[model samples]
Target: MIINAFILFLSVALPGLLLTRMKSFSQKRIGYFLVFAGAYLFSMTVIHIIPDLFLSEEDPFKLGLYILIGFFLQKILENFSNGVEHGHVHSHGGYSIPYLLIALGLHSFLEGSIMTDSIHSNHRPDSVYSHGSSPKILLGIVMHKIPAALALMALLVAQLKNTKKAVLLLLVFALASPLGLFFSEFFGHSDVLPERYLVIFFAVVAGSFLQISTTIFIESDPHHKLNWKRFSISILGALAAVAAQIGF
Candidate 1:
């Protein structure tokens, strides 16, 4: 758990910290990275998380309904977040910073919550990473976090107009996921929330992952023009998820 928290923190903090020193950034490169991360995230959900969720004897339709709720819940959050979770950036343009953070932070927290290792052990007994999330899911979050940190710093810089202040705010964003993981673990161990409820929480997060990853793909090419480089990168990303799925 500490390792996940540290790594998750560094994934964003390191990139955002470095960007605070720079005068310019390459959104194009970051976009490619988002593409790959999105692919891996999507594949992880399809191959692992969703399957594990269904491994429960719970009602499939109900679980799926919760997933659909999470999918649109992310959409609602995007209305406030301006789609920042998937690397979409927009002009601050009368948008409240607090609202964006609340929406995005909720997202960050839930993803982290699902990272609790014991939550999925019964479901993922076949997984090599039997502890927390399968390696692919954690990697997916980290992969996306790097580009996310970049876009966030850009947005915050544009709005706050102070690198120091933006980095400070970014630290809050960086810690949100790990806190989710930590608290989810805490709740499970203490019986603060029942294990079945945790599984429901996992389903909801799975829905959000679907929303975020699909959005990345759609937004990556609004004009529908084929970009082979991104195409290949996405393939590579999916393969990486498959490798993790098979315990490679």
Candidate 2:
């Protein structure tokens, strides 16, 4: 669990911290990477996570409704995050830092909550990892986080004009996800909690994944014209997801 949380933290913070110094990390390059991450995430959610959710005895219809709620929940978060989860860097001046951080933090927290080791153990009893074979979901989140962290740091540095302050904010955002996982693990051991609740939680997270990934695909190329490179990268991303499913 600590290893998984550490990997997630690095995924969400390292890229941004490194890219801030490079100066040549263009948004266009980030967009291409975002497409790949988006496709990979979408594929994992559809091919792995959603199917696992259905393995539960819960009503599929109600599970789907929770997905829809999660989808909209992400939409609401995006309004405050300025679409940071999808790699959008807000340019408007005078944005509220507290509001943005809160939204981002909440979203990250939910993401981390879905990555419980106990849940993974319940779902994949035969896996070797302590957390089970849910690396696909974890990898997807890490892939998505790279560009998000980059965009977020860019915005924060621009807004605060202080490297120390920006780094502090990045640290806060980075910790949010791991903290979430800790809290979930802490509370999940209680006897009163039903096993099906984890399934519902996963379904909601899958819904948010759907929304974010689709948005990345749609918005990555604003012109709506065909680009073979982007399309190829997207396909490669899907293939990568499939490979992870089979290999891991």
Best by lDDT: 1
lDDT of 1: 0.84
lDDT per residue as tens, model 1, 1-248: 89888887898899888887888778788888899999999999998788888887679999999899999999999899888888767664666789988888898998887777776655647654454454557788999888878878888888899878898899998999999989887887876777788878889999999999999998987889988899999999999899888874
Query: In model 2, which runs have C-alpha deviations exceeding 4 angstroms?
Result: 120-131
Error of 1 at 44 (Å): 0.4
Clashes of each: 1, 0
Worst 10 residues of 2 by lDDT: 124-133
Q: What is the lDDT of residue 91 in candidate 1?
A: 60
Colliding residue pairs in candidate 1: 117-132
Tens digits of per-residue lDDT for model 2, 1-248: 79878988998889878967877677888888899999999998888777777766789999999999999999999888889888888566566789999999988888888777565555545543323444777888888899889888888888899988998899889998899788777766765678788778768888998999999988866789878899999999999998988877
Q: What Cα-based lDDT does every candidate model obtain?
A: 0.84, 0.83
